[model samples]
Target chain A: MSYKDKKVITIGVVRDLTGLSERQIRYYEERKLIFPERTPGGSRKYSFADVELLVEIANKIEDGVQTHEIRKEMLRAQKKQNQEDVRRKMIQGQLNAQFGLRKGPTS
Target chain B: MSYKDKKVITIGVVRDLTGLSERQIRYYEERKLIFPERTPGGSRKYSFADVELLVEIANKIEDGVQTHEIRKEMLRAQKKQNQEDVRRKMIQGQLNAQFGLRKGPTS
Candidate 1:
């Protein structure tokens, strides 16, 4: 499927991918750990990145880390990733300017 | 200090390294999630790798993964890392042999 048209995964698909139980997944949602979208029928739909994050979370808990600490670290990691993305975009913009591409107005 | 002679860190050290409370670290030990060495005085001592694992575990929980599921994934990841290490060693041995080093007995 085209990137935009790729289907969002159901809760069952997420469970299978992450090897987590439905109850556990729902518990995570209740904890506000993940915020999957919902269908009009009230079923949850997870993005692929969400499933990957679940896998990463599973890996962390197995190592004897506490839940609250894990939440903090995940947020930190996400913020770091965002910063890296911004840096990459800035570098790309510089290269584009060198190549005579008119700089679009900075967002 | 050489790697082998580096002092084993006490439970307090581990707590600081992992950003976990003493009670939480003890609870993890009770769950058999970690097996730190004990001092003659009955205090827990953690290796650097053990503390690193604790950090990894904390990261996972923050991502909303369940504890048991995290445990399973951690084991899988550990096994994969071990296999990769073995493969690297084998490749290194092959390269050494090509450089005129005699093949050592296989472990």
Candidate 2:
């Protein structure tokens, strides 16, 4: 359920999994949409998260969403995720403080 | 503090924060160690996580570790993190089941 393995899944596997072409994946990279890591031998490698992202991008493009618009949407989503993370940490900190946990955020 | 902002910070800011040269950062990217996202216009953008990774890579290189070794270590660390995520999820699932939560992983 997690795609935390960075630079392990090949582009070919991503292509197979997402039903996307190599060219389309590379184009997404060029559009600054997905950031796949390269192998030491210079082959592009993707993670499952990248594959999911590609499918989402492909879906949006099919719905007539521009690549630039997708990029903006990604930024907004990233910002929202960041805010949620902060909020979670703050809640955790407050809970810790309320429980008199010595290792609370402020401590 | 979490560094979850992807592709928001610039390479210059990364360089300033990590005390690493641009060439060194690019070299790490070339070595397939760090994966920075590119801007739409093609400038490299880094997140705070990338900056921290660069600093760690720099320290390792200073300690005479090869880039390939660093890459292997990264893969190992990533695998460990993935396992941890799975373990956490399993624990969450068990807790949810115990609490009669309807939205457990299996449910």
Best lDDT goes to which candidate? 2
Model 1: residues with Cα > 4 Å off, grouped in runs: A1-7, A102-107, B1-107
**Which predicted model would earn the best TM-score?**
2
lDDT of 1 at A33: 69
Top-DockQ candidate index: 2
Residue-level lDDT of model 2, residues B1-107, one tens digit each, is 33244444556556666899999999999999988876556778676578778889999999999999999999999999999999999998888779865754863
Backbone clashes in candidate 2 total 0
Model 2 lDDT, residue B57, Cα: 94
TM-score, structure 2 vs. true = 0.46
Q: In candidate 2, residue B72 scores what lDDT?
A: 97
Off by over 4 Å in 2: A1-5, A103-107, B1-107
